[model samples]
Target: MKKVIEKKVYNTETATLIAEYWNGLGEDDFMYCEEYLYRTRKGSYFLRGSGGPLTKYSESNENQTWGISTIIPISKEEAYEWLEANDKTEAIEEYFSNDIDEA
Candidate 1:
């Protein structure tokens, strides 16, 4: 079984991680995806998604064939939906809470 990873990560592309749903550390799949939820200092919520394929299908396939990508400002509704689909209760509460945070 793949080991579960629980650690903090800093991605300057988006905001820092407030609640890490999937770290994708010990995954051995061909395509691995990681989801991290963050809240800016102004209380704005954002989900930082980052991932890529583990191996290339061809030797000359370095032209970005796969659709692996990371979107910076994922919609609040979409973020909530993702959280709910993943069953992140604690993150769900913190996501809609009145507390402030820093990215």
Candidate 2:
């Protein structure tokens, strides 16, 4: 995997708060910063953030700020393996045993 480092500039007010948050992070303090592919009911795919097994799906669309329709956790190793196996597919979307409720 290629590592790309991009710098983002936040406004002075936001920068202060962000810097504080960054400084507060200890070695063990980490969030699930991995991006995983999710396939919607329409068969369209999109990348969304994964917060591992404990992450909850928002009850309302209005509360879903992450642009994630669902929370399905896939590990980096598994994602890489799928990419290797399928020449045309870069990422793999898993289907649940039970149909997901849209309500």
Q: After superposition, how far is residue 20 of candidate 1 from its true place, in Å?
A: 2.0
Model 2: what TM-score? 0.21
How many residue pairs clash in each candidate at the backbone level?
0, 0
Error of 2 at 33 (Å): 2.9
Name the regions of candidate 1 deviating beyond 4 angstroms: 1-16, 23-28, 54-71, 97-103
Give the per-residue lDDT of model 2 (tens digit) for 1-103. Answer: 1111233221222211100011232333233233334333433333333332223322335543331223233344543443445432312232321322344
Q: Compared with the true structure, what per-residue lDDT tens digits does model 1 show for residues 1-103?
A: 1111234333434454556655455445546567667654554555555454653221226574442434355556766776778888687777656443445
Q: All candidates' TM-scores? A: 0.52, 0.21
Best by lDDT: 1
RMSD of 2: 17.9
